[model samples]
Target: MKIEGKNVFITGAAQGLGEGISEALLERGARVCIADINTEKGEQTVKRFQEKYGQEKAIFLKVDVTKADEFESVFKDAVSRFGQIDIMMNNAGIMDESRWELMISLNVMTLVRGTNLAIEHMDKLKGGKGGLIVNTASVAGFGPGFWFPVYGGTKHAVIGFTTSWAVRTHDTNIIKLFILYQFQCSKHQTLIEMQYKFCTGI
Candidate 1:
């Protein structure tokens, strides 16, 4: 489908791959909602996009995906600002060292909360063609993760969610689900499938 004219809400859009994806979508003339905890950085990114492409390119939102209220409010605000939501990427997440609670909140709870909010908008599609949801995961979920056991389990959960929900959502034609694993963010981040682990001796 054509990305132009589609309303896509992206989380964790302050930097990294999320920012890159937002830039690409803006270039394609998509209405993008750049959401993240780093409000200043997020707004700055939007400013740069607008300066390059004119004023109506993107909007920035300070969203903490772990908070149910924030999740709900972000989607609601986005819908209120822009007619409807077409695409969603549950990309706002964090990394912690072997902390089970931190891992669950960051990797799993964020996706749960964000998807719940996003699905509310997605299911309201007319003609069964609103949009899709994409999730980010890691290779460690499947393979043997040496240190981050909770992180691995969380990704396994993400995989399960994507596999089970993709075909069952309301808008079959509108809904497309994508999952990515083991994308190297930087040298410090380890790819479980790769042998060279960044063993920081933490």
Candidate 2:
């Protein structure tokens, strides 16, 4: 596995897509730290992962993605354990509430916070050389489907932010910048292994 020894951090990782990714990466021999708002589900997810991937390979942290302080602490915790966050998956997002507030936080602010939080720790990960961010940009971001306007808008924000993040990486005195898009939900091991190979070219 390309990321076999690398450290990984994932947000919204208590269940669903986040859980899948964490399991996949851990199975490949990457140490992972899961950040989730749902502490109960997060612990449960960790239990399930350890059952299969082994206890030493994975961990979890309580993180409210909307809060920058919590996001900052996750970086510290991940770094303390693995000395870096070589790969970070910003996969937390939602569309549950009413339009205005939901769209504002879910679509725009969440992605923005994830990006900012990752950037805050990128220097330590690569010895100031920059790193990889696999930001999830939905197919919805590229198209506006009926009844999905708000979700689509936030997805578009993710896309735009991804591009901007790449272009600006150099400004921080870092190089070898990388950002990728995930359009759909595929199985965990398959997609994670593929991504590790493609990103690291191993």
Best candidate according to lDDT? 1
Candidate 1 stretches with Cα past 4 Å from truth are: 124-129, 170-172, 181-202
Q: Which candidate is the best by TM-score?
A: 1
Q: Candidate 2 local accuracy as lDDT?
A: 0.70
| lDDT of model 1 at position 160 | 81
Error of 1 at 97 (Å): 2.2
Task: Give the per-residue lDDT of model 2 (tens digit) for 65-107.
Answer: 7777767777787778877777777777776536567556755
**Model 2 misplaced regions, further than 4 Å:** 97-100, 124-129, 170-202
> Per-residue CA lDDT of candidate 1, range 65-140, in tens?
7778877887889988888788788877666654678768878788877776666666655333457777777666
Candidate 2 clashes between residue pairs 3 or more apart in a chain or in different chains: none
Candidate 2: residue 42 lDDT (0-100): 93
